[model samples]
Structures are given as structure tokens and as C-alpha cells.
Target: MKKEIVDPNYKGEVIKHDVAKYVPETEYVVKVLERHVEKAKHNLKGAPIVVAGGYGMGSKENFDLLFELAKELHAEVGASRAAVDAGFVDHDRQIGQTGVTVRPKVYIAFGISGQIQHLAGMQDSGIIISVNSDPEAPINAIADYVINGTVEEVLPKMIKYYKANNK
Candidate 1:
């Protein structure tokens, strides 16, 4: 132990003076105690339906239609990595191998072309419905139904139909 001139109230600290040069390593183990996700409209992992969009949505203003459709379907909102990176949505809402995985009963993808990373997260969904203008979009391969239209053209109709039918 050595005293330092820096502090008036100096607490003795252990000092290693003559020590062999050695590399230090760290090993960590994480145990799951309890898994908890807040129950909310946008809770992706637990929602029975997920309404997801992608960079193909074009802009943040255009991307917002997914939220309206999600609300009508009582679904959560998710986004592709490209959508999150492009500032169309938040990272928490991202779904893929790099983000949260969801196996919802219904996954309605809007504008997403289904990058392989994204497919990993949502492929287990009970039913996948893709809405894209691209008839050859990779997402179409996995989807149970494919709507050959843009989200702008399809989402309003979906929301309107759901709203009217709910009444």
C-alpha cells in the first residue's frame, strides 16, 4: 500500500508493483430468470399478428400506414433492418436475425421484399401475407397469400374493412 498526495482523506488502495505480465480474460454466463414483455399494442414478440414494413415503403410518411393497419388488426408493428436504418421506424420494431424474432399467427408484410435475415425471424408464422408491387419479391415464396399492390393502395382498404366489420 502506498499513500498518494492527491487526496486529503486518502484511503489505502492495494497496489501491485512487481507483477508478471499476463493476459486477462473474461467468461460470462447468462441465465434466464424470467422473460417478460410489456403487453401493448406494439408488443411484437407476443402479438398474434404482426404488420411489418420495409425500406420498400419509400418514406417515413408512407411507412406510417402500417401502424393504422396494425391497429385495425390488433397487431404489432415491425420493420425490416433497411426500414429501421432508413429512419422509417425504430430499432426496437425491427424484426430479423439481427433483431427480435416473432412467430405470430399471422404476419402481414407490407413492402418488405423478405431479405433472408428478415425471413429468419418471421418464417415460423402460422400464415404470412405479403403486400408488394413486385410480383417476384422473395417474400412471396414464403407467404401464404400475396397481394400484388403497394401498401398505400392496400392498407386503407384493409383498415376501412376491419373498422366497418367490427361495428
Candidate 2:
């Protein structure tokens, strides 16, 4: 029968065996494991609101204004590479091709020119509001709302409005 099964030319007789009779019966018990959730160390990643500053913000001292606005809006502060490179902000706060990526519900860019590298990190934001002095700035192109004014001028009014209405 083995020779008949192996030989292609052989007219073979078919046979069936009860393999189940020799097989062992086994049972499996599945246990659900509890999920371990870890707390995030960085507060910026999941921030609902983010306020990013760029080189156009002028000086490091100007970041105080940005921070004031961020406080009013309850937003995290982010910075472009230029701002970081200029020593205006810390490296961890930098957001761009070389920095941390963010997808905030509302991203308010102040003085950021919208360089491609910078845009890559933040373009996924749900709503983008850009405040820039230059009307032709690249950031304005992707902005849901573009405010054509210096951050110094625009931020204060915005902060005032939020405080007045949020109360």
C-alpha cells in the first residue's frame, strides 16, 4: 500500500484510519490580563491647545507674552527650530522636522513663518490659527484663521477676549 501510494503509475486501494482514537484531548483556559497604563512625562504631546512661537517673535523676553497668552488659553507652549536655535526657548519645546510632532485640537502659531520642516510637525492640528505680520507668510496658507498683525499686537487682544468671555 505504501508503494502504491508513492508510485504515480500504481492503481491504489484507498484506506481510512480513525486517528482521533489515538489523539489526546486537551483543554485551554484563557485569562484576561489587566492593562497597565503609564503616565506621560511630557505634557505637550496630548495638549488640546498649543501655542507655537517662531523667530519672528523677536526676543527671548517676548516669550513671556506668549506664555501669558498660553496661560489664558490653557495651552502648552511650543517653539519652532529657529526660536530654539535663537535661545528663545528650550530644546524640548521645539516643534518641527527635528523636534517633537504634535496634533493638537487647536494650534495657534504666533510669528511662525510656516517653513516646511515646521509645518510637517504641526500640520495635523485640527484647527490652525496663525498670527503673523507678513500677509504673504507661508503659515497663512495653511491657517484656518489668519490674523495679519504682530504677535505683540494680536496676542494681548486675544488674551483679553478669552479672559473676558471665559469668565
Candidate 3:
């Protein structure tokens, strides 16, 4: 019996692109992740912070606000696939069924409408806090504390409060 040889150019063969355009160009993601890890190692950190699905965080610029808040709080930043897909965050910091599963001490949901898939990853967190303009947002249902307001407004106040009280 003769052995058959497979063609290298077979149509069924899968090929990956040389570069991925889907990845973000921002260097801040790396800086933020590294800084948070360093802070955690030094015990100069706050509770783990997972920012849920991106609903009101409409653009990458909006997501930067979350980074600012995280920096102020000295907390780790996490996000949902929607936020990554929308370029609000890098894929590396995603937290959901398709991403990293985090059980942060305080999971902050900012502008996240809370899809079930996203909630499955962080629902077991020690404390769940959500800030949304709509009180009826699904994320509010699972949150231990709900702040019905805009992230832009609430995050500053929150950062201030946590720093003052925790310190």
C-alpha cells in the first residue's frame, strides 16, 4: 500500500495572521497592570477591583477614566469582553467567562449593565458595588451596594472616600 502525502497548502489548513490589529496600541494598559502588581506585592494596595461590563463607557477615552480611578485607589483594574471589544480596555485585563475570573474583595461595576456571563466571573466577590445611571440595571441586583449615578461623578467621590477612610 502506498502512503498518501498531505499538501502543505491544503484548504483545510488554518493560518494565523502575522499581526493582530485587534490588540490595543495604548502603553498605559501595561503600565497600569505592572504598577498594580507591584503595589500588591508591597502590600500598598486596596481591595481587588473588577470593573464590570462597559455600558456607559462608550469609548477608549471613557475607559481611561476607570484607569485614573484605579490608580487613585491603588487597585487592580478589570473589565468585561464588551469593554475590551470596544477598545475601552486591553484584553489582558478582562474578567468574565471568556476572560480572567477574579474574586476581588471589592468589585466595582461602573457603567456596567451587567450581563450574566460577565457576572458569573465576579459574583462571588466579597463586596459588590455598582454605579449606574439606571437603578434597574441588572448589575445592581447582585451588588451589595448600589450607587445610582454616573461613573464620572461617583468615581471621584468614591476614590476620595476610600482613601480617607482606609488610611
Better of 1 and 2 by TM-score: 1
Would you list the clashing residue pairs of candidate 1? none
Give lDDT per model, in order: 0.89, 0.90, 0.74
Score residue 86 of candidate 1 by CA lDDT: 97
TM-score of 3: 0.65
The digit string of per-residue lDDT tens for model 3 on 1-167 reads: 49989888877858796554666567345554343333333221234655553757677876776766677666777777887887877776777788767787888888888898888778889999988999999989998999898877887676677668766
Task: Indicate the worst ten consecutive residues by lDDT in candidate 2.
Answer: 23-32
Whole-structure CA lDDT of model 3: 0.74
**Per model, how many backbone clashes are there?**
0, 0, 0
Score residue 95 of candidate 1 by CA lDDT: 97
Question: Per-prediction TM-score, please?
Answer: 0.76, 0.74, 0.65
lDDT of 1 at 41: 42
Candidate 3 Cα deviation (angstroms), residue 114? 1.3
- Which candidate number would show the highest lDDT if scored against the true structure? 2
The digit string of per-residue lDDT tens for model 2 on 1-167 reads 15534666778778887866766454225555798878754578889999999999998888988888888888999999999999998898899799999999999999999999999899999999999999999999999999999988887888889889888
lDDT of 1 by residue, 1-167 (tens): 49856877778989886533453233225557898987654578999999999988888987777777777888899999999999998899999999999999999999999989999999999999999999999999999999999877888899889999978
